[model samples]
Target: MQRVLIVEDDPLIAIDLQHMIHDLGYVTSGIANSFDSAKRLAPHSDLALVDVNLVDGATGPRIGQFLAGEFGISVVMVTANPEVVADGIFGVIGVISKPAQPATIKQVLEFMSTYKHQLVAHPPALRLFTCDRRGPL
Candidate 1:
């Protein structure tokens, strides 16, 4: 199962995205309203649904960069801002428009399903962490 982390500030949206992830047979690791919580969970996540703007106005691109570069988690950016996605966005595998629908979220999962192996640091690393999903993580 894919260990997915949601980085959305809106509680309802977070819940909805979490459900969408589960429907796709992926497990949600956590919910992060800000970049800090997101970064803290990146080490364990395989896929991330990152919002472009957080509570503090910080952008998700920063979080996306960290997830891909440091933690190796695949990132899917959800944004309504064109400028936010403009010119040389890196690390994220795909972009979804804001108010992301179930289908859009599903597509993101499809994009991430390919990298589920990275969700775990290593085969033996499973003994070192607790996975939210069943099976060997």
Candidate 2:
């Protein structure tokens, strides 16, 4: 089973994400509201669902880079601000907008599970990026 770590600041949102992930048949490694907690839990996860504006300011991009580059973890940015993708951070495989529906989350995760190496996007909704292909959605 794939283990996912959620890096979200809002406790309620994190819980909702956890429930969604569980419903999709993936294991929730844990939830982190800040960079420090994310760093600590990154090692135990296969993938990470990150929020752009974390409790510690806008550090989600940095955390995503670290988790992907250092730990070889797959990263998907889940944020209200999709502009973070413009930053061109490394190791982010995809971006999912905030308030993600169960179907959307399931779709993204299904894509991640299959095309873990390629850059895949769900369009106007979820945008994906890979090292080979990097640009705005």
Best by TM-score: 2
lDDT of 2 at 18: 97
Error of 1 at 137 (Å): 30
| Residues 55-111 of candidate 2: C-alpha lDDT, one tens digit per residue | 899999989988988888878899988875765566687688888998988887777
Candidate 2 stretches greater than 4 Å from native: 117-124, 130-137
**Candidate 1 off by > 4 Å:** 115-137
Please list the C-alpha lDDT of all candidates, in the order they appear: 0.69, 0.82
Model 2 scores worst on lDDT over the 10 consecutive residues at 128-137
Predicted candidate 1 versus true structure: per-residue lDDT over 10-126, tens digit per residue: 888889888888887789999998988997888779888788788867668788777877777877677666355654246665466667677766755764665454542221111
Q: Who wins the lDDT comparison?
A: 2
